[model samples]
Target chain A: MTPIDEDPPPPSPAESLRMIAEQREAAERQLSPDPLVYHGPWGVAWLVGFGVMFLRHGPGGTVLVAMPAWLPLAVLFTLLIGAAIVSGVLAGRTSRHVRGRSSVQGAMYGFSWFVSFAGMGLTLQRFDDGLSPPNVGLLWATVAVGLTGALHMAGGAVWQDRLLFGLGVWLTLVNVVGTALGPGWHSLVISLAGGAVMLLLGLVLRRRPAGRPNE
Target chain B: MSELDPVIHAQARLRVVAALSALPEGDQLAFPRLQEILGMTAGNLSVHLRKLEDAGYVEVTKTFSGRTPTTLVCLSRRGRLAFEEYTAAVRALLPPPST
Candidate 1:
C-alpha cells in the first residue's frame, strides 16, 4: 500500500495526556489577575446560585430561615453559593473531557462560552429600554468583565466540563442583564429563570456530543 | 478500517480535533491560547503534540510572539482527510433506528 493509503497511527495514552497538559499550561500563561480570574469567579457565582435553586426547589419545604431585611446581602449569599457549586461541577467535567481528549476540547470549551457571552450581549442590548435602563455605563463595563469570565471559565474547561464554559457564559450574561434590569430583588427573577435554562442546558450537554477522540 | 481502535486518544488531543474541524481552511491556534482552553500541564501537552507533528496529522510552526517562542497547530491536509474518513466510518457503524 502507498504511504498515502496508510493512516497515521492513533495517538498513545501518554501523547494524549501530554497534549492536555500543554493546553492547560498555555491557558495559565494567558490568565491575568485583573480579568480572567475575577470575572471568572463572578460568572461561577451566578451559576452556583442557579444550581442552588434546583436544590431548594427539588426538595420539599424545609424550615425556611428568615433573617434580616438586607435584600442585597441575600442575593449575594445565594449567588456565592450557586457560583461555587456550578464552578466546581463545571471544572470537574471539563477536566474529565480534557484528560480524555485533546486541545480541541479546549477550543470547544472556549467557543461555547464565547457564544453564550455574546448571546447575553445581544439579549441585553435588545432589552435596554426596560423598567430600569441597565446602568448603561456599568453594562458596557461588564462586557470586559464577561470576556474575562469567559477566559477564566475556558481555563476551567482545561480540566472541567467543556460544557461548563457555556454555562458560565449564560450565567454571566444573565447576571449582567439582571444587574442592568434593576435592584437585586427584581434581579432574582433573572436568576431563577437563568437557573431553569442552565438545568436544561446541562441536560443537553449531557446528551449531544463533540465528534472524534483526539489522536 | 479499524473499528474501536485504541490509540493515544486523550482529552486534549480530541479537543484539538474538535477545534480544527470547526474552522475554515487554514485557521490555526497558538500554543498559549490552546493551553488556556485545555488546562493541562505544559510538558505533557508538548510531548503529545510532538507525536502529532511526527504523524503528519498536524503541522507545527515556531514563530516569535514578541521575543517569546510560540507554537501554532493547524490540521494538515492529510489529517483533515483522515478525520473526515474516520467520521464517515463512525457514522456508517451507527445502528439505524426502528421505524
Candidate 2:
C-alpha cells in the first residue's frame, strides 16, 4: 500500500479565524436554556393533565356527568399529582448531564404555576357561597387558563422563544373564547384546542436536534 | 498585539472556556456532553481541561449517577473573568467601527 500522510497541514490564519468564529457562535448558543427541558416531556405531561380535567368537568364532561362530581375532581387531582411525579423523575434523569439557567428557569416556571393555581383556588373559595358549582368551576377554568397562558408568555420572553410565546398568545385567546361560551363549552374548548397545541409542541421538541436553538 | 490571556488563548482551551462561560452562573456541563459539543476526543479534551484546571480556571467534579460515574465541568469565577478579559483583548485588536 502507498504511504499516506497521517496528519493534515495546519490551518491558515483565515481558516483558524473562521474556526474560532464558529466555535464562538456555538458557545453563544449554549447560553440559552435547553428548550426541550421544559417544552418536551414535561409540557406534554401538563397538557395531558389539563386535557383530562377538561374532559371530566368541562362541557364535554357529559360523558362523566353520571358519576359523582367529586369523583372527577378526585381523579383529576390524582392525575395531576401523578403527572407531577413522573415529570420530576424524568427531569432528574435527563438533567443529570446538563446544567445552566434551565434549572433556575424551570423552578421559576413551576413557581408561577403554583402561585397562579393557589390564587385561583383562594379566590374561588371566597365566592363559593354566591355562585353555583358549575359557574364557580367555569370562573376557575377561565382564570386558570388565562394565568397559565400569561406565564407561558412570560417564560417565552425570558427564554427568547417565539414558539413558546406564540403558544401563550393562542391559549390566552382560547381562554377568552371559552369564557364567553360558559362552563361546559369552555372546558371542551380548552381540552380539545389546548391539548392539541401542547401535544404538537411536545412532539416538535422531541424531533428537534439536541442543543439547537429554539429559534 | 493586545494583551491576550495566555491561559485562554489556545484554540481548544478557548473553546472550552467559551462554552463554560455560556452557561448560567453556577451551572455545569457533564464531561461527555462537553466533549461532544466541542467535537474533541476524550483524551484531547482531558488534556485541554487539565490545563484549565491547573490554572484554577475550571472546576471539575466527579459524581455518580446511579451505578455510573459522571464528570461535570464548570467555569470558575476566575475563569469567567479571564475569558472576559481575553475577549476584550481580541476586540481591542480590531480597528474601530466605521461610521
Q: Going through the candidates in order, state the TM-score of chain A alone for each one.
A: 0.34, 0.69
Q: What local lDDT score does residue B32 receive in model 2, on the 0 to 100 scale?
A: 87
| lDDT of candidate 2 over A1-215, digit per residue (tens) | 12122222223334434455667567544443344544444445445545555656666346543555666556546755665576565556545567556777766776777777787877778877898877877777678778879988997787677778899999999989988887777766776677656767767765664343332
lDDT of each: 0.49, 0.68
Estimate the overall C-alpha local distance difference test score of candidate 2. Answer: 0.68
Pairs that clash in candidate 2: A59-A184
How many residue-pair clashes does candidate 1 contain? 49
- lDDT string, candidate 2, B4-98, tens digits: 55667666676778677656676778998788679899998898888789999999998887898989899899988887776666666555788
- Say which docking band candidate 2 falls in: incorrect
What's the lDDT for residue A22 in model 1?
53
Candidate 1 chain A weakest ten by summed lDDT: A29-38
Interface RMSD of each: 11.5, 8.8
Name the regions of candidate 2 deviating beyond 4 angstroms: A1-68, A90-102, A211-215, B1-26, B30-44, B52-72, B75-99
